[model samples]
Target: MNYNIVMGTDNKTLNPLVQQIYQKIYPNIFKGSKDIVTELFLAVSYDINEPPVIDLSQSVQLKKEDFQSYYTSELSEEELFLDVQEEALILNMLSKATFQACFPNINLKLKLKDTSLLNINIKVSAKVNIQTSIEGKQNYLSATILTADLEIKDAEDYKKYIDELKKYILPLLIHVLNKDLLDKIKLPALTFKDVTVSLPIPVVEKSFVTAYSCIGARQPDTYTSLNWPAETVFAGIDSHAIETMAAIPFPLKKEKEFSWKIISGHVLAQVFNPRAFVIQADGSIEGKIDAELLAQLTLKKGFFKISFGPHGKATIKATFKPVVHNGRLLLTVKDLNIPKLDIDFGIAKWAEYLLKPLSFGLSLALNEIFLPLVSAILRQIEIPIMHFPTISFEIKGITFNIDIIEAKTSKLENQLLISGIPSVR
Candidate 1:
């Protein structure tokens, strides 16, 4: 994986101050403890995402007199000065300091080129560096002490440090990336027509049997009274009943070539416990229908119908023209009604919220009060019935051309007869 780090606006401006603070507070932060210095070094190194890759080559030497005399001794008593640079200590604190300040919120972008090689990039700005001098003196001697000095070699090292830091922060980065992508993308819509459906019907049979037996009297002859002798009787009967049914296959065999217009739309019917119907997307209506069947099908011109409810209760009826041509059935419809109750419920509220909030409220109120009444009416209507709601759309007619292939007896006995068509490629 290749990784890159770019500096944010704040880091560039605050870096210098951070350096100065670290230098001045380093000794105090350690509280005169040697182990404190070691810990601080390790902490900074770790903060930069790079654990100590190399062992300390040398111990950090602290010049007590250089820093102590400035804070504890007075130079005003005597005009005293001395060369304190020799006593000034040089510690490898810059690398650690830089790593500590930059590691936490470092922005890293990584890309994988291949399996073998990894590249990393980092950018950082706004670095603050601070230097301070302490004055101390002995009789007739004036001395200036250099307190602290720290530096980061270059941007490349900073980039490297950031790359190392990513090992620990990669999970967070991935999470952020996913959230951002999800917010920007939209799910695609499902649309299509030419739907082939299969249904199953079962056939079963039952039977019963009867038998008879007679008991004979020992002293038959004249005392038998000519009795028929009580007889045990058995009877039998037979009946046929449907048990389980496999799916009935109908390939929508084209009976004739025909052209028809769908006036309304397509409907999808579903049966639940009770029953419910929904209108699916207009785009879902598409099919090559037999023209003769289209004419035979009774659908209001320019309209489509579909109904469904609980218990697999469903009915899809549309009016179009069915034409017979070359012993083939062609059916066509302009509109389609696909029951999409699930989708409609979600979209209804969305539309109300988006387009007309007041109307939405009124619609909700009407539904609550009249929904049950409408449902009762639907249940009472024995014959297949369709309900229509007004919707505005440009009327674009669709035509379906189908070829009738063959007719066959449905596996569901004589109850269902089906014509099969060759599968469309």
Candidate 2:
């Protein structure tokens, strides 16, 4: 399991095969409805040192040199001023847009009339305030509020409501936050079953080991085998998600020891050829625990049912650490040793002194029932874990950012190597 991804040089990294992401780059850098009529005439035009409120019987004449001649600045000897490289080229083309593909028929909203006020509506559409009546017909603009709210109050009127929500409520909150963080850039998946870990009975007497009662078994269920083959590289400089992997398997069977207690007497084990290994350095997961136990002794003091010869197998060597309490992610079962066991036939030499104290009480109840039955079946398997497929942008006032960064997986070309960086926060 080795994954590493961190891309963001303007995202667009792809070609792991064929390649495709041209939806005509969204009308070639957004031209939709002529950029919503130049962002509703620069969100209600501005840039004035004075001069605005007009009403000359019906005509059009409200310009601050059409918003300071679409903002121009030089001064090193040329003289101009409203920069940020031309409002960051219309805020990076309305941050890769979405709000219904940038306003065609408008709708934008953002309420909260209480706690510090903050409204902001938009609506529009019906030929957006049509007008042309001198007798020529077609009429509709005379300010009947073609839907346009605003409000904004705290923080010193937030820079005059972000300089009039950078023309059209900051590109409709950067295309509705680039479609809500491009649907959270992918990552999900998990699974598990037949879990019932419970072990204790240690009381080693002369050798000394503690715990003493709690036996249970049944942990055979799996899922979380993954693969994404490849494809999903976008790079204006970086963006990735190719070759994903998470193949996990755990097979432990021995007639799933139904259940048991003490007193009356009855034990039956069969753990054999159990091999596991996943030591990413010290993350732990070592295995090898062959087994086979059978008992039924109650003797002259009370009960009896003797006939235990399967005491013919034992070979330990364990370790399965991976613990993360509180937020669970366990697998404890560290360092357990058995070495060898195959008693000497003929009632297995007095049943190896009554199965050496019931084989050290089933090895301290299989290491205390493998951490809460494999951490409650891996917290009930979830999924997505970087499925990849996203794109969105915007960079100033009405925030929005995400352009891939880190995604790795390549179980021999199963494909997945995504990484980029530059959009933190």
Candidate 3:
């Protein structure tokens, strides 16, 4: 396959994205001043029927420029698309300073030649400044010459002038745009550096575009492979890729209400030990920890507090169901049990009578106190995603955060699919 990573965005998403871009970059849209000339003002109006289109490009070409196809095909291929709220655009300037221009109506379009040659077609309304030379035998009735402006008299001349503009505007605009905006327009929508995936080069289609790349292979690879240029606007990854997740633990915490007297329990400590998140199709993660947790028994006499306590160490085996809440990773301990437990507290033959009852009490603590307390602490525990947020791209010196919608194993694919959309921080 030419590509394994496929992503796309359609028109329904494009319209608002254009408007959103307009709001952000509007203030800085060609914002600069020369003491030679300053105070420039620009106002653009758009019709509901048409809106702007944006792409991931370092250089933008004028609509009327000659077509140069990057990947041409004898048979037509579907175009790539990403509808974003806003994007940076470049424009040329000759002189500014007390200058004002209002484009009454603007319609922008993306046209593709062959497989992926693209040019942005912009149609803007401009009122032409024309001086009239025609004079009627003005007041000829009185032999007095005068000049009068009539509508239809200059109609043909006006058409010719506007038609000539299309030819003149493109070459001039493109030259200036390419020279000034190459490094300034940062498109962060497709940057996935943290995931180690390169943004796919976009291909032009009829009205949409799709970006595809055979970039990086997922570790602990997934099944049900997809054809390049798939319909989903998403990133597919392996669960094993999140190295930090392995540090997360399902531990029994000490709480005054239920666990003040309990021995400590912590799993998957990063300094010495780490674990992997093994995702199952049902949205559960199952793993066994080899580390030990302590369970203690105590026998005390009156106020003197002479005591005997038998402490046990257990290798905790557990399964957890993780969920995201307000951008926090919270684990719900689905199951916690000890398959093996070792306990030995040497006591005199006189205290041997206390061993059986002590054993029974400890067993009761395992089911009644230990399990419930562990589960409760696990429930209250939360790993804030914002603090340890996943990084994606860096543009305009700003990093993008993954707004994950769901993290689940696709039974058919046998891979953990993290579904998300673009979000600005």
lDDT (CA) per prediction: 0.22, 0.29, 0.34
Off by over 4 Å in 3: 1-16, 19-237, 246-252, 255-276, 289-292, 295-319, 326-331, 334-357, 384-414, 420-425
CA lDDT for candidate 1: 0.22
Pick the TM-score winner. Answer: 3
Ranking by lDDT: 3, 2, 1
Error of 2 at 71 (Å): 30
Per-residue lDDT of model 1, residues 159-255, tens digit only? 5544333333332333232232212222111100121111111000011110111111111111111111111111100001100100012212222
Better of 2 and 3 by TM-score: 3
- Arranged by TM-score, best first: 3, 2, 1
What would the per-residue lDDT of candidate 3 be over residues 1-425, giving only the tens digit for each residue? Answer: 34444334444444454455444443332222211111221221212123333322222221111111211222233321122211111111001000111222233221222233212223442211111111221000000001111122234544433332244332233322223422333333222332344333343333233444433432112223343222223433334432234344424344222222332222211111224557677756665544333433345434422234333454455676655554334445577664433544434567777555556555554445434444455445543211113334433444344343433223224333333333444
- My TM-score estimates for the predictions, one after another, are 0.15, 0.26, 0.43
* Residue 76 displacement (Å), model 1: 73
Maximum-lDDT candidate = 3
What does candidate 2's lDDT look like per residue over 71-154, in tens digits?
333223133324658545433322211011113222222232232333333322110111111112111111111122233335
